[model samples]
Target chain A: MTMKIDCPFAAKILTVFIKEELAKFGFKKGVLGLSGGLDSTVCAFLAARALGPKNVLGLIMPYGTSFGEDVRDAIGAARLLKIRHKTIDVAPMVDAYFKKYPTENRVLRGNKIARERMSILYDFSGREKALILGTSNKTELLIGYGTIHGDLASAINPMGDLYKTQVRQMARYLEVPAKIQKKLPTAGLWTGQTDEGEIGMTYAELDEILFHLVDERESKEELLARGFPRAKIEKIMSKIKSSEFKRQLPPIAKISSRTIGHDFLYPYDWEK
Target chain B: MKIALAQISPHLGNIQRNFELHLQAIEKARREKAGLLVFPELSLTGYLLKDLVETAALDPDKSPMFKEFKALSRDISLVLGFVEEKSQEKGLFYNSAAFLDKGKVLHIHRKVFLPTSGMFDEGRFFAPGRNFRTFSTPHGKMGLLICRDFLHYAAGYLLFAGGSEIIIVASAAPGRGLAGKNGFATSRMWELMGEAISRFSSAFVIYCNRAGLEDGIVFAGGSFIFNPFGKRLVQAPYFKNDFLVQEVDPAEIRRARKNWPFKRDDKPEVILEALKRIVHDYED
Candidate 1:
């Protein structure tokens, strides 16, 4: 039983990881933005177990014209868990910005919504002094599907590594509402938008490709030979290569004698 | 309960070796029947790495090193440190601690206080955590404080307010004094910090510090356990890898708090006013 667990699926051990993490940081509760999608729902379930039902707060931030069922499913999951939850209608705030700047694209507006939701989550986190748990999955992180400084922000992330397929499995294990578990994955950025549709590839295929590419370190030609579409493999590889910057901190120039991103390589507790 | 202070000397960029050492410590802890086991700061990746962007990066979900640590969770309730790759966000590296039990990670605490002082540039490598709180576990209400975080009065006060019975300080304290000189200054500072912990929070404190050297900076491994009364219960060997075990009683915390009564008699507003003045002087 004293075997060493690999670090990648460390997020899978959420039951123990979240609790110990919270205790270590002195956090008794957690707040997260619930989008009624697989990622957020799984995060909510994990946070509830980590901090308890009373300690986990779910804030549903819905922009204008959200699918009604998605909101209901999110609320339903919270109710099922008996966790405290609230709804923050972001339609008015998002609409106001769009009205003022009519030329803004929906993508720009969606990014605003994401940032606004994060802002609210952080505000509540401050008031409650609760940690803001993140919900983005590994697939999103690898493919750069998340909005930078928006849905991508959190005090700590528990699901950064579970692929989209793995997230669905975790949702099932956590007994998430079927409505949420079965719903099409979407960022709710616009009407009739689905994650797969936008990405132009199914998660099963994406995960398979990514597993070969990242975990197996397969070459592009090998991935194509392994039944991955040439165009899709190229696209996913491009994302993984390009979004490496997004995965890291802002580059610090070697101005100081010991630069952080460069020379200074101590643990967060180095000064203790 | 026997508590094992697993003062592991981590490799700066070797996840596999560090994780193997962690597993070895857990086995030792179990054999000793220790109820809790603790590891040093960033035990997964060594401190003072040349490029954390490259050295400290870990995909806990996919990294083999993380998987090894997770499997080790079944036997002992272990605490260890590592770097976690955050989501695809700008500036999202995390200094993380994982709580492991029963073959799983019970919880994780990201480092909140990023040091930006001399020879330290954490603010540039990781995002600063904003929340200060406590966590509940089978062990009890516990608080996790990283290095430099215990120096912050607010973090300590918040831990007390959140009901932390035991405060664990996992650190890599820099050793002062020359190669041939005694580390008197570092030891004195650690003693002062222990006294502060006993006076301010009145909780049983366990400090686990890394031993050995990294990037020319020698870690003064002055790890120790402090009673609620500010008494040193056990002190590990300094400047070397060592482990010490001490039994902690919850009732002793109550006794110490009752004896001190600092928690009940303090004026928070007065303390805040003084702290604010130290940071900035505002005109009335």
Candidate 2:
């Protein structure tokens, strides 16, 4: 079952959220890592709409093994939105580090690239006096598909609650370039790496299962009865269980009566 | 009498700023020549305040703020929400709404139904109130219900039976779901309840909801006024602050009560006896 969202309504709420939340944090400008993927492109559109094109900046960071098409698309997305953008090749830093700590693992290389890109975005955020807008959708967040403290790091996320399929719908509504919207989602850590190829399932299938399991709170038995493969359901559940740490602040040992995350609970917007 | 609904965005845990905001709203309402101005739930302190509730709680009798509000009430009546500290019972707090009229604190209604399920933790913090009393005002007998209190049918029914002609609900309901055209699903839910209660009880229903984002939860600000016949008079837009004033004629209440007679035919004694037996049986 496709979960349909009212894109225009969602866009209105998200743009307002971006503008107001940023203003509350004493920020009128926003900076984001534009990967030319659906999620990042959608966020760029929202940021431009919220903070105005001049106030928004997109950083297109690429590694040596990154696809040329991906780089062009990122630049194209920024141009379409009429937001200021800069391209910084991160091959030297990532390659130099990997030379000393040599590894054939693709996941390790991808994690480093993700972290490197985020670091550049943060640096630009500080230099430009702007907040870093997040790009991770709910599907990647729940499945632990992205690197922690890497793509997951952001000041605020407008699209965090939206699923991947919903993000695609938003992309269409925002009139994001058809090339960027139709292209397979990739982190661009290396050539021929796609989110669906690595995850071994289409976003539609995963979103349906996740919508039922997470949003609807369907039990395993109920899922099986609804014609979902038991192995796939179990795999999704385990992924969610394992990725719980990425979604939360690191736990602190409770020594005092009032602990930060435990007894001493306060909203993040407190006193702001 | 003209009633003004002040849809405001309170700074979280910043009582001084929220106080200033309230003063501004009071000034605007007075300028608009409204007889009474109603604000959303916890207009003095923002919602989603987990640990700050204790810090924000104030004794209405001792606090100078209430004194100021009382002095301001000399010009126009006021109704607003705050975290009420029980002076006699230390460390206990109640999510309370106070009705100020003629330079005096007339009535205070602590929220009876503290929603503690599914993203809400009100029951964990606030002690549930035990009464649903109505107080007399210049317009008519009025009752105050917090956000969750209005959702309960019995709460509105009890107020209707207690001779209430106007039911004012101050709410901080977060926007949820996007299946509706006008506003969020949660917002639509409140409007339906407001319409139903106004029609059933033959009372004017005035709902004031807050605006702005607090910890990712956006308070839906579709504040509305419904006449005794359940016809919507005016509505503020969603997700934005607005000060809406609408003339509320008390004669509409008489006309509606005459047409429906829900109030005249209401049998509170039967309900009381049934509840007494049911509670005794359940406990036994």
Candidate 3:
């Protein structure tokens, strides 16, 4: 007898929720930063379906020395889906920042690039009166693989749960370009940088362990017994713990009868 | 028109449990003869489930919960939140809301604004929705806004421009009051939103919020209704399960809009001045 594994059809289900939520908000258009990666590609496909191609705006912001093929693939995917799209090169803006600051460190340069990209997305969202759709997946969010207030920012997200591997699976289902589907995951921060290569573990393994530790509440000893490297576990666990601040709103100091972060308890729709 | 605000709790990762709660609310609304019933944002699946939310999300077309909701739409119109599948493509999901009446889904709104800052990562698990239009119900033409959408003036303005007589906001706003210092500011933010809605459109506004704790983040249940003149008509208790039912007259909305004429006074200079204030450029 074979036992069936339950697959999260999360993307499909979230599409409906997003539609209804948008209706509730009285918004007619959605905008997203399409980075030609597995996450953004998946998000774009979902947004296109949820809001219709006419109402979805996909902005592709590429910095200097981006993988040319990947950008082309992003354009191709948008065309295939017939979603509204535009490409804005951030090389000039990024170069200006560096020229003004004169930073040679790749990490600093990468951080500036991420933040610049976010600023552009938010600015465009205002101009279009559209919501900014986020593209970070659960693996990145859990490990804080994203920059604070940068790629980690958006008005709403639809793929925070799927791991990199799961995002790849969904990408295939969405018919994303093969180049994007096969490309090694990267923040495109600098030349020749890949997420797994930098993190020292593949998403498949990381997601498996993270699920066990966070969702299943497995202990470190149990994880070690199950063949997870103790060092890797420690590193990942520490990252999750340290990054908890990033996952929360700014700490508020309560001083009133009904404070929001402290005593005020209500749903998003409590005023009806 | 009497509207019922359903500030009920939703079970985490449990679609069936939430659907039952919604059904119960519908029954209560019908018994009360409420013309409209509202629920909180993402009420079908408790907010901030992290990755668990994705696994538990349900497709609107195929979900039994959606079917039950449609069936419940006989005597009253209802608004509720759920995870829905995008019809045009595969593997796409949205944070969606549905307007159900007379056993049909009249309209569906996907959340266009996803909050990804600080404690919210809506941009992580849901896609943004598009299309701004008000729905015409027996009670009146009404507009809807979700949690973060109300923070932006453009969303409310669009609804007013679309001729909405009333605007309803559904939210699962995390309890800032639980935070020792910032609670008052958050509360003030909600109050300001109420004032903005009335001032901008001179239309009645209703906010329905959820209550309870999920994943240690408590919801601040300050659900309330504002008359067309921006006066508080009814307010619900915070941090607990509660409901409010109030009657609204369409004539009040017309009278308020006619009297204020704020939309007419909304010129480019006025907009520029407002933008300056929003950007904190008080020197101008």
- Classified by CAPRI criteria, candidate 3 counts as incorrect
- Provide the lDDT at B69 for model 1: 67
All candidates in order of lDDT, best leading:
2, 3, 1
> What is the TM-score of chain A, computed separately for every candidate?
0.91, 0.97, 0.92
Model 2: CA > 4 A from native? none
Give candidate 3 misplaced runs (Cα > 4 Å): A1-8, A255-258, A269-272, B1-284
Model 1 lDDT per residue over B1-284, tens place: 56789776676677766767887888888788887898887888876653555556776667776676677666667788888775464356677776777767666677888788776767776766666668876777788877778767677787877778788878877765321224434566766787777656788788888876554355777788887788888888766678777787767788987988877776767877897887787555
In candidate 3 the C-alpha lDDT for residue B150 amounts to: 83
Which one is best on lDDT? 2
True contacts kept of each: 0.11, 0.68, 0.00
Q: Interface Cα RMSD for all candidates?
A: 15.7, 2.2, 18.3
What TM-score does structure 2 among the candidates reach?
Answer: 0.98
Q: Across residues A1-272, which tens digit of lDDT does each residue of candidate 2 receive?
A: 33787788889889989998898889999999987788999999999999999999999888864466787898998988899999888999999999999999988998998999899988988999999999999999999888999999999999899999999989999999998888888867778888888888888989999999988888999999999988888988999999999999999999998898988888889865
Among these predictions, the greatest TM-score belongs to: 2
Return the TM-score for each candidate structure: 0.52, 0.98, 0.52
DockQ of 1: 0.04
